[model samples]
Target: MPRPASDKRERLTEAAITLARAHGLEATTLAAIATEAGVAQGSVYYYFKTKADVAQAVADGVAESLASARSTLGPEPTDALVGFLGAYVDDAAAICAHGSLLATASAGTGSDRAHREAIDWLAERFGDLGFAAEAARARAVHLLAGIEGGAALAHALNDLSPLEREATHLGRWVANASA
Candidate 1:
């Protein structure tokens, strides 16, 4: 029996993200991604038309997690924001490490805007916690910058402590902003 299309697409995007992170986007090729994904080279085109398209899917995957995180939070906005903070902190290594590659490709449809879309999603959630619209957006951007900055540093130094600390601080900041 044939595997599901969604599963194949998911695998391809994930492979792309992982490869992009490890090898750098410029070094990661469609052929390489197909090999990494364990799909035939031609099969890759069935799901994604270009590397940017696959990159965009990767972004959407990240954003989907944010949406899922938001849904899991209870009715209280402040607590939810804190939950998001913790989640981000936990995922800091991945996010920070992939920061450069992902950001550089922020031009495609779907997942290309995933990073900004994720931020926007978080900002909206922040608003739910009683912050003014602008303030909520500012807080979201602030958290993003700090976490990604830490990620970038961690990526450079081969360490995760910076990302962890930034994630923690941002969580606190989000809590305080909501209070």
Candidate 2:
């Protein structure tokens, strides 16, 4: 039987993400990614020129996921920010592993610009919520770091309390900080 086209590329990207998450970016190899995706190693090359390309795609996917989550936020900007923070805080475990992969890969691949682009999107959204531009940018960076740290703590301690607790504080901070 013949196979479809897009599935291979999608699978390779997904496999790259999963491998990079389970194993650090340095350890995730093209062969490993291909094995994880259940495809020939050569096929990954057909879609992505290098492992870094896959990493970039993973980073892009993470950013897209955050934006997609934010799309469900209500009309109010403050509410939207709160919802965005909550989305991460509430799912810290998964978010941690997933975000770590993107973070690790972004650094390894020198895709800092891509990471910054995502952060910029976030800052712009906050700016729309009435925060001063610089303040919005700073706050966005702070929240992203905070949530990632919160997620790491949640994972290391095998406890969700820190994340759940941080979510409330984050929501309040965004509200007050923007005001």
Q: Pick the candidate with the highest lDDT.
A: 2
Give the total clashing residue pairs for model 1. Answer: 3
Error of 1 at 131 (Å): 1.9
Could you say which candidate leads in TM-score? 2
TM-score per prediction, in order, is: 0.78, 0.79
For model 1, the run of ten residues with the poorest summed lDDT: 105-114
lDDT for position 96 in model 1 = 62
Cα lDDT of model 1 by residue, 1-179, tens digit: 99654688878888887787677766778899899999999988888887777767766765565567668877776777677666656776566655776665554543445567757876887788777889888877887677778889978888888877877787777766732
The lDDT of each candidate is 0.73, 0.74
